[model samples]
Every structure is written in C-alpha cells, then in structure tokens.
Target chain A: MIGVFRQWLAGLPAYLWGGWGAIASLLLLLAGWEFASQWLDPLALPDPRTVLATLHGLLTEGEAWAELAITGRRALTGFALSLGVGSALGMLAGLSMTASMMARPWVTVLVGTPPIGWLVLAMLWFGASDGTPVFTVFVACFPPIFIGAMQGVRTLDGQLREMAQAFALPPLQRLFDLYLPHVLSYLFPAWITALGVSWKVVVMAELLATADGVGAALAVTRSQLDTAGTLAWIVAVVGALLAVEYLLLEPVKREVERWRTLA
Target chain B: MAHIGVTAPALELAGVGHAYGARTVLSGIDLHLPAGRIHALVGPSGCGKTTLLHLVAGLLPLQDGAIRNGFARSACMFQQPRLLPWKSALDNIALGLKARGVPRAARHAQARDQARRFGLDDTALGQYPQQLSGGMQSRVALARALVLAPDLLLLDEAFSALDVGLKAELYRQLLAEQARRPMAVLMITHDLMEAVRLAHAVWVMAPEPGRIATHFRFDDAPAQRSDAQVYARTAGLLDDATVRASFGLDAPAPAAPLALAAVGGLRC
Candidate 1:
C-alpha cells in the first residue's frame, strides 16, 4: 500500500499539472483581457464577468437553447447532405478519369468562389429562409469530403487490390475490407475539416438569410443595441459546437481508431 | 498414407521468356515444382528469379512461354510483408479468408490459431503492422499466407529482413508446416546456405536474359542442413565460374568481334 502510494505521489506532477495546463493558460488570458478592458475603453471590451453574467441571463431565459437547436439542425442537415453527395460524386470522379475531368473545373470554381456570393445566390433561389443557410452549409462542407474520398480512391495500393483480385473477393467485401480500410487515413482528416467548415457556413448563412438560429439571434440583439446579449449568443454557439464535437464526434472517432492502435 | 503416384506438379514453366521494351528479363526458362517439395531458385542480382516467381503466381503475363499449374490456390510473401497498416496482426492474417467470403467467426478462429502457432501472443495479435517490429510483421505476413492453405506458396526473400537466429527458427517452422500440409513452395533467395537449408532442389539462374543455369538435387545429401558439407557445396555452386560468366564476367574475348555467335552471349 505504501509502495503504491509512493508511486502515485511520484506521478503527481503529471496528474495534477498536465491536464490543467491548457485551462490555466486560458484563464490567465481571460483575466488579462478583463484587466485590460477595465483599464481601457470598457464600452469597446466587455469584462469576463460581464460576459458570464450575460451568458447566465441568456441561459435562464432559455433563449440560448432555441437558438442552439435551430443552428444545430441547419448544421447537421447541410453537413449530412454534403457528406452523402460528396462521397458518391467523389467515388465516381476518383474511379473514372472522364468523371474527374468533368467535375474538376466546376469544383475548383465552387471552392474558389467566396461564401458571400453563394449566400446571395442561395437567398435569391430560396427566398430568405432555412434553405439558403442549409445550401451555404452544404456548399462549404462538400469540398473537403469530396477531396478526401477522391484522394482515398486515387491513392489506393495496387498490390493489395491485386491480392483481393487473386482471392476473388466479392465487390462488397472488397469495398469494406480493402477499400474502406485503405481510405480511412484520408477520410478522417477530411471529415474533421468538413465539420468545422459546416458550422461556420451555417452561422454565416443564418445571419444573412434566416430570422431564426444563433446568427439571427445575434443580429436581433445587435439591432436592439444589446451588445452583451450578442456576445452571449456568440459564446453559446461556440460552447455548443465544442460540446457536440466532444460528446458525439470525438467518441465515435476514438472508437473507430481503437482497432487501428491494436492492429 | 499419402499417395505419391497421385501427386501433381504444383507449378510448371516451359520456355518462359519476358522482356520490357527491348530489355529481356527471362528467356527459355523451363522449370517444374513437384507437389510438396521446396524448390530454391538462387541467382545473382537482376537475374529474373523474382520474375519467374511472379509468372508462376500468375501476377505477370508470359510473353514467350507458358506455365501450367495444378494448385487451386496460391499466395505471395513479398520482400516486405505488405500488411495493411489499418489492420491488426490478427485481422491482417484473416484478411485473405475474409476476402474469400469466409464467415467472420470461423475466419477469426482460424487466424487466431495460426497466429498462436506462429508464436504471436494476444498482445501482438491486437497490434497494427506499423506498430510491429520488422521481424514481427514478417511473421504476421507468413501467418497470413499459411492460414489460407495455399497449395503453391511463392516467397521472394521472405526471411531476408530477419536476423540469422530468427531466420533459422522460421525456416524450421516452415519446413514443419510444409511437411504437414505437403504444399509446394518456390523460395527465391540470395542466401546460399538458406537455399541448402530448406530446399529439396536448388536452381541457379544465369543473368542477361536469365535462364536456368544449373539445377542441384540435394536429396543425396542430409536433409538436416546444419552440416558443414552442405554449406561448402552450396557455396561452391554460388561461386561457380559458369554462373559468373552469365553475369558478363571472366569470359574469354572472341577472336573476331564481328561474329553473331560471340555477340549473342551479350544479347538481352
């Protein structure tokens, strides 16, 4: 018992300090900002406590939850549609030179063109509602996922594929065992990239086109001259996004990768 | 009892020749791998030994000749293990069966059994190929090949990356496994002693559009090849002057350089 306790004590530095290091740094930055804002123009920079109080007010009134739900729905719907369409098109483009040639110029144009342009077009097409924001999210999310799937197919090992041919693996088995395993390294990074872009696009589109969601709520607060409320909504959006990533995507990613470490 | 009369040649190559553009790699290469026997194809660098192995495995097309085979199944163990990086050692081993439509439960059990036989513990079994040391990865690749019950196994320097002791151990296990299954193996190696150690017959390939330089049946010699005599004999063959001549070395110059016959020796 003494030996175990001694061992535990020896590991105390890592346990006590390692995990909290980032949090400590963040706290230090927040405190510095609070101090600087108080000393300088308080009108321009809100203190951390003021932000917290605004956050509390928004939470108590249940406004944050409704805004969160709207934004969340738009983000998920657009992201899912992007993933589905992008993966299918990416597969075709990657597998066939003709398809790739046909899609490349247009995809390049789409990727290069700014979101503001697409939002304008989407609003014109969809008449200033959820469709516009969702379309913007879809447009932002598709490129990364498409590039990932295409690259995954393009860079597949010929040797392993030949091995599958010799073994006479059925097409479905080949996809799951050979293709999917080979593609995951490329796919994971792409998915993570798409996740971030999806949220940003959804918020931007919401602000421009919709009268609901977090971005719309921020606009409303701004119109009412409630700067504190606007900041609170912005904080809520970021917090909710982080929570979704930590709770859903991260656990799924960890589970998917566990076999990789073992293997 | 195993029926000797009913046994078939696992692989047969006749007048096999291949060329890339104008540079020929193989020419008039005739060979046969009798069922259950280990055949060693030894050659100097760039001598089309690997080409022959590939041909027999049906990986490359025959340009000048044909190879007949009785084996229903074959597997190749490359110079590198060529394991899937995303798969665990156990899963990689089971991949061949999985691809062949074997049920998950049965395939895993068979793979696990082979893994244990190949001396991979559960911890090792769970690890990915990238996480494994070079030697461990090769063992996992070997386990993958053996689990499939391949009638013809084409090995291209499978044990080259391993240490001397590990090579010897794997060689023993391979010999034992071959005995049990009566599967034919064509192993390409630069190690002369390794050739003598495991093969029933050794064929030395000559370079420059390589052909069968010579064949040695070591059946008259002891099967257990730790003997000094076996090493001496194999070393002698490895260093033979004719084998050297094939590599454009130590050949007498022609009296007249214009003749087709003299230049034909240098022809690719």
Candidate 2:
C-alpha cells in the first residue's frame, strides 16, 4: 500500500510538487487572516472564507467576466505596443553608441517618473476611454524592455560578429539568426517585468480614468463599503497576471531557451 | 578526385601592411600563392600572422599595399570552430552556400554530401555544435569551409587546439579535399613542424611591425613526406641562426617562452 502511494506521489506533475510549499504558506496566511478577522471589525478585514465566497460569487456573475476580458485586452494591447516600440528603439541604441547616448536622458526621465504620474497625464490626454489605460500601461512598461534589449545587443559576442563578417552573411540573416537569438537571453527577463507592470498600470488606470473593468468594479465596491468584494477583485487581477505569465510568457520563454540546455 | 584546372596565381600580396591608429601591426609583406598549393605562415605571437591571413581573406581592408585575389571564392576557418551554437552541423555547413545565393534545398543537400566527405555521419550532422565533441566541431567547421568549394582556403591556426590524433586525421582530410580540387591554402601556425608537414612553402615572420623574415620551399609533396624527412628539415631550420633569431630563440628568453610543438609527420 505504501509503495503504491509512493508511486502515485512520484508520478505527480513536478509543478504540483513544487507548488506545495507555496500552498502551505498560503494556508498559514489564510489562518492568520481568519484569526485577525475574529479579533477585528469584520467590515475592516474580512475573513478568508468571506473573501473566497465573494470571489465565488464574482466568478458566477457574467459582468465580472466581461470586466476581466476588458481589462485583459487593455493590458495585452499596451504590453504589445511597448514590446514593439521599445525593442525597435533599443536595437537602434544597441547598434550605435551615439544613439545610446542620445536615448539615455529620455529613458532616465521615463523610468524616474512614477507610473501614477503617467496615469494622470494619460487620463488627461486620452480621457476616460480604453486608450487611457493602454497608454498608462505602455508608459509604465516600455523603459525596462528598452534597457534590457539594449544591454543584450551591446554585450553580444564580438567573435560571433567577426565570424559573421568572415562568412559574408547578408545583413538580414545576421540580424535574425545571430543577433535575435542572442538578444533573447537578455530580452526575456525584461519582458516578464514589463508584463507585470502592464497589468498593474492597466488596473490603476481603469480605477482612475475609466468606468469599466475590474479596477472600476473595485472602486464601486470601495464606495459601497463592500471590503470582501474589493479583495475579490484584487484576487482576480493577480490571478489574471499569473495566468498570462504562466500560459503565455513562460511557455514561450521555455521554448526559445530550449537550446540552452544542449549547450 | 577530379581536378578543376586553375591557371592564375590564387593570391598575390605586394608590400602589404596594416596599422591600428598609430601602431603598425604588419609592414612590407610580399607573398604569392599559386593555385593548388598549401602555404604556411609561421611566427611567434604578435607577429601579424593572423593579420596577414585576414588581409588575404579580405576581412581587413588594404591599408598600405595591394592584394590581388584571382580565386573565384574564398573561405576562412578560424582557430575556434566558430560554428553557430544554435545551428545543427548540416545547417552551419549550408550557411556558406546560402550566402552565395544557393537555394535552401540544394544547399542542405550539398552540405550533407560535404559532411559525408569529412567523415561526419548523419547523427553528427544533425547535432548542434555544443552537442558535439571538440574534434567533431572542428570537422564540422572544416566541412563548412570546404562546402563552399572556394578556390582559396585561409586557415588561421585552425587545428592548433586539437589533440595529435584528431589533428592528423583532419590533416589527411584537408589534403584529400585539396586533391579533389585545385584550391590554394594559406595556414598560420606557431609550430614549425606543422608548417613543414602541411605547406609547399613556409614563410617565417618577425614581430614589432611584422614582416616576412625568411621563405623556404620544399620539393617533397607534403602529404607524402616521411617522419625522418620532416624531422630532418625541422632540425635543419632550427639549427640555422637566421631562422632561430626570427623566432626569438637567439635572444635572452622572455618571461614566457613561446609554446611551439613539433607534430612529427602526416601519418594518414
């Protein structure tokens, strides 16, 4: 019987085993929260059970799904725009020292200015439309991606460049085959950071500038003094971020880096 | 082996020189490589041997002299294999043909055929450079160079890193390939014996604004030379005061002695 149980445990997916520690930590946090709720006002700090029930209720409602979809679209659109524009500009900077020097001040300014500042400007410029949230996300996420890609290109092996020249490979082939794959090692980490920022900025923008999406729903829950509902929306936002990271970003990163293990 | 008749001198260098900013690396170099011969450049480090190879291969611009290349195509094999880590051996070999505007299918087929000629089997051809052993990587690199069917082949200390057995096997492969075509080869090496074993003519170079110190031509075909003959020639060259001085052996030894080894002869 013990041997059969061991076999079943061993056969479990690695991620399931890996996540057990996180699961244990989460249970401990929930227990602490439950204890705190019993000691404090229920309205101020809802118990884990109450928050979970609120999340279940929100999941069943069609409005919650629509809001999630809207927020997801905004975040993704903004992230995509940032990736395209940032990588292009980053490559240009990487290729030319003069360009890198010119770009430094602009990158510093953008990075130094908080995401809230961009959110305020976006809300004023783009108004309470979908554009405001997307613009905010773009403004928040572009700098990291740009910096990562630039460093990647700058640090590419000089020997490989010499080899490419010796072979007289076409410019396009060199860019695609030699440069792109090498740059990806630097690019992937920045992309993950950008993705996280995109979700956060989009939600914040929605709460401040728009009348729809999870952030707007959270604002409504706050005004109504529904603490459980507010926590449920926070949980939903975090869940969406993790879902995109695991299902989209991580898989693509793993596929691209599969060659590394061989090396 | 089929010979493609090449009539003109494969490469001609006249008063070739190079400098970086204020520092001159090579100066007043003159050499001629006729078709269907292997020429070797022997020198200590910082003697501009690699710089001259680059100049001949057209990787470096002519700064102070004229280099006339009569060859239709030229290929270089560097000291390191320099194979794309991401690419399979077949793909790496096919890259040269692809650069010359060969179609994908034809280049791949040609690469596979060339791989077989280098004794790289189907399994090795399918593997990436990082997946292969050091010797296998070198074989793939040699295959990549020869697949171009270049009229002139430039090797910049290409076999210096390999063990003795692997080096000998590659030497035979290189000779056999040359026999199939009338390609002229220019190799750079620190080893005098290696130069003697592989080269029809060996040029000894001097350092500090590098220039050719001496040139020696051998009557014996490199692939056919016996161990005794190679050792005798090497011993004869080493005994000469001019050759020894050019190699910096006559002077008080520097902090680090130049590591030069004699690979006895071509066994294969």
Candidate 3:
C-alpha cells in the first residue's frame, strides 16, 4: 500500500501538468458564458461573476456543504454497492458463455430504463428518505460496470491462459497476478462512467423525490427566481465531480496502469 | 526421495491418442525423454507436434492411453513469448518460482541473475513485455522457463522466431545451462537444422492421424557439434524416404550429371 502511495505521489506532477488543457477549456467555457450574458436576461443565464458570488455566499453562509454532503453520501454509497455486486457477478457471468448470454437482456433493461422512470418507482417504494436517491443511483450505475467487467474477462487471451496453466500457477496467483491486472484496465473506465452516472442520477432523484440536496437547493432557487443560485448549485456539483475524478481517481489510475502507458 | 541412480526419472508416453470430437489428431503415439536429454519433434504445420507437447505439459486432457511424467516440475515456452503484458520482465521471469510460492525477494534475485545471463540488462528487466524489443521479450521468456530449475522444459518452437545470430547465442546459453544443471528438454520446430544442432534425438511426425514416422539419435553432445556437421546430418536425414514423405516432399528427379557443387549448395 505504501509503495502504491509512493508511486501515486511520484506520478502526481506529470498528471497535474497534463491538466493544463482541461483548465484552458474551462476558461474558454467561462468566457463563452460571460459573452452570452450580455444578450440574455439575467433571469435565465447569469454571468460567471454572479454565479461565482452566489456560490461563494452559499459556501460561507448557506447550508450548501451539508446538502452536498448528504447527496455525496447517497451517491457514493449506492456506487460502492453496485461496484461490488456488478463486478463480482459480471466476472462470474463472463466465465461461462451460457450465463453471459442470459445476462445480456437484463443488462439491456437496466441500461435502457430512464432514471426518471426508476425515480417514480423509487418514490413509491422508499418515500422521501435517502433510499430513493441511493437506490436510483445504484440502478443507474450498475450496467456499465457489469458490462466492463464481463468484457474484460471474455477478452482474455487464450495464449495467456495456456501460459498460466503451463507454468502451474496457483488459483490465487491466477486471480491476482493474471486476472485482476487485466480486469482493472476495463473496470477503471467503466467505474469513471458509473461514478458520473451515480452523481447525475442521485441529484435528479433528489430534485423530484426529496426535499434536500444540491438538487433541492436548485429547486428552491428556481422557485425563488434566483437563476444565479441555481447555476451555483450546478457548478458546485460539477466542480465536486471534476475534483473527485481528476484529483483522486485519475492519479490512482495512472499509477496502476504505469506498465501499460510507459513513455 | 526415490533411489538417486535408479533409472533417472524419465517421461514415458505409451499409445497416447487424442481426438477432438470426430476428428482424430493423434493416434498410437509413443515417446520417451530420459533426464538431461533433449528431444526435438519436427514436422510440417498441423502435424500435432504441439498437441503432443501440450499433452506432456498437462495443458490438454488425454483422451486415450497413459503418460507417466516422472519429472517433479516442468516449465513451458511457446512460439510467442506469452509474457503477461501487465508484468515487468523481472516478474515474468520469476512467474514460475512465484507459482511455487517462493518469497518475492528470493525469486526476484534468482530471476535477475537468470535474466542477466540471457542478455537482458537491468532496464529491460524493469520494463513491461510490450516495452521490450522482440528479441528481449524472447530472452525473458527463455529466462522465465529456466529460472524454476525445472526437471523438464517444454519449448514449442520457442527459438524459431529469432534471427540467426540471436538463435546461435541463445543456443549457447541453453546448452550451457543444460550442461550445468542437467535437465531434460522437449522442443518443437519445423527447421531440420535446428533439430540437428540442439536435439539428442529428432522425431518426425506425419499429419492426418498424426503419428511418429521415424526418429534418429545423434551420438555427440549437442554443444560439441559443428555447423558443418549439423548441415551434413540435416541433409542426410532429409535424404531418407520416410523423412521426406513426412514433410510431403516429392522424390528427387533422376540423378543429374555430376557437377562440382560449391559450399551452401542444395543437397538435391
């Protein structure tokens, strides 16, 4: 674990340097928003300054962190549950052709069902508690992770499997040394996608089925005609998602896949 | 341990037959490999030389007859390197030892030693398989098989992909390793000269119900044989009717007028 942390730490400078393009694109987006604000009514799309000021006010005085914390908890909880179950089941299913074949339509159903449709069912089932958002996030995030793991298993080279057998690798070595490393490549990308899905779905679920969260704050701002406040909530959630993805997950991914992406 | 000198543990296959559903690939196969000996199986493609090797390596199930593997441990190198792309070359070299539950530091030390002998430098050992050149990857694969000190080493066309110079260098390393440690080797190849140079015994296989057509044994140790001797022996073996038939080659035309042929000339 310490070695992993060291590698992650050693790799951080390059990783941060690679973020210049993303920072520039974000700057461009801010400029575009500022330009658009000159023509549109402030009621519809407030300029970047107004949004940033409102977001600052919410951070200092309003209960923004508490609501966001509640939403983050629900999103992460649901995402963790699905990550475990989906990856486990997907690997198991991938090992057998019959199982994966049978699982195809089920994955399709999960992926195809709109989160709004599930949110209504969740509202009916869990009422106004955290269950509605958490369950909805899980349902929304499961398919990508599952399919990623399944493909990872199925696409393993037959030659490598033969090599493993010829060398007499133990079951644990086969799992850790051979299987896990290969699966992580596919699993990591799907995890990022699933995390994005979980965040988006939880917020949507909160807006319709609950009375608190960034989504609820947005709803409150909408009712009060506070367009800047609504955008501020959006920026907070988006900014949080970007921070988690870039600062945390991306660094970990780079360290793990150093063997794959050597310069 | 069994009596030390009492019949040095050998692999004996008797009447081994294998079929994939309706199609039979191998039938009535018999072979032997005593300790510290090298046997090469030679034939055209699709001749089930690989199938027989896989059977000995326990990579495939036997459908008929019996194989008695007396070696305590064995390792295999395939036509391709087959190193784990995610693993550093050092880890790949240490894979067999790792599978045997040797501690990491010990295996890494041993692998590093063997890898250096195989012409891999420290940087190459630390790199992943994809990052290494083809020749370096092959060296790592060879080192991986040898690091375990296996009683039997299986090579399925392992060195066939290398350039002539690299092949000669590796052949020296392999023979030196074998001379020092005294382990058995079973290799597959299409090149007859390779068989003549490396193997103590060469078995030719014919496809379509694959079976051993004939076998020849050389008296001198492989390392002592000269290149001219290898060429002469390979040509001598190729002249045999059964060996030519196994390879699906037609008989030479009526003897032409004798002419003084230069060096490296076709025997035909």
TM-score of chain A of each: 0.85, 0.89, 0.96
Off by over 4 Å in 1: A1-19, A39-43, A88-107, A152-170, A259-263, B1-9, B61-64, B220-222, B247-268
DockQ, model 2, C-alpha based:
0.49
Question: For model 1 chain B, where is the 10-residue window of minimal lDDT?
Answer: B259-268
For candidate 1, the docking band is acceptable
Selected candidate, larger DockQ, 1 vs 3: 3
Residue-level lDDT of model 3, residues B106-202, one tens digit each, is: 9999999998888788998889999988888888999999999988999999989899988998899889999998899999999999988999888
Q: Choose the strongest candidate by lDDT.
A: 3
Provide the lDDT at B97 for model 3: 96
Please give the ranking of all candidate structures by lDDT, highest first, separated by commas: 3, 2, 1
Q: On residues A1-263, what C-alpha lDDT tens digit does candidate 1 reach at each position?
A: 46545655565555446647766887898789888878765456777788879999888889888888989999989988998898777866887777777877888988999988999999999987788988888998888888888888888888776666655678887787777766666777787778788888888888878888988987887788776677777778777776666545654555556556552
Give one digit per residue, the lDDT tens place, for model 3 in A1-263: 89998888888888889989999999999999999999999998989999999999999985889998999999999999999999988888888999999999999998889989999999999999999999999999899999999998888898999999999899999988988799889999999999999999988999888899888887888889999998999999999899888988888887788788873
Q: After superposing the true interface residues, what Cα RMSD does each candidate give? A: 2.9, 1.2, 1.2
TM per candidate comes to 0.83, 0.90, 0.94
Evaluate model 3 with DockQ and give the value: 0.69
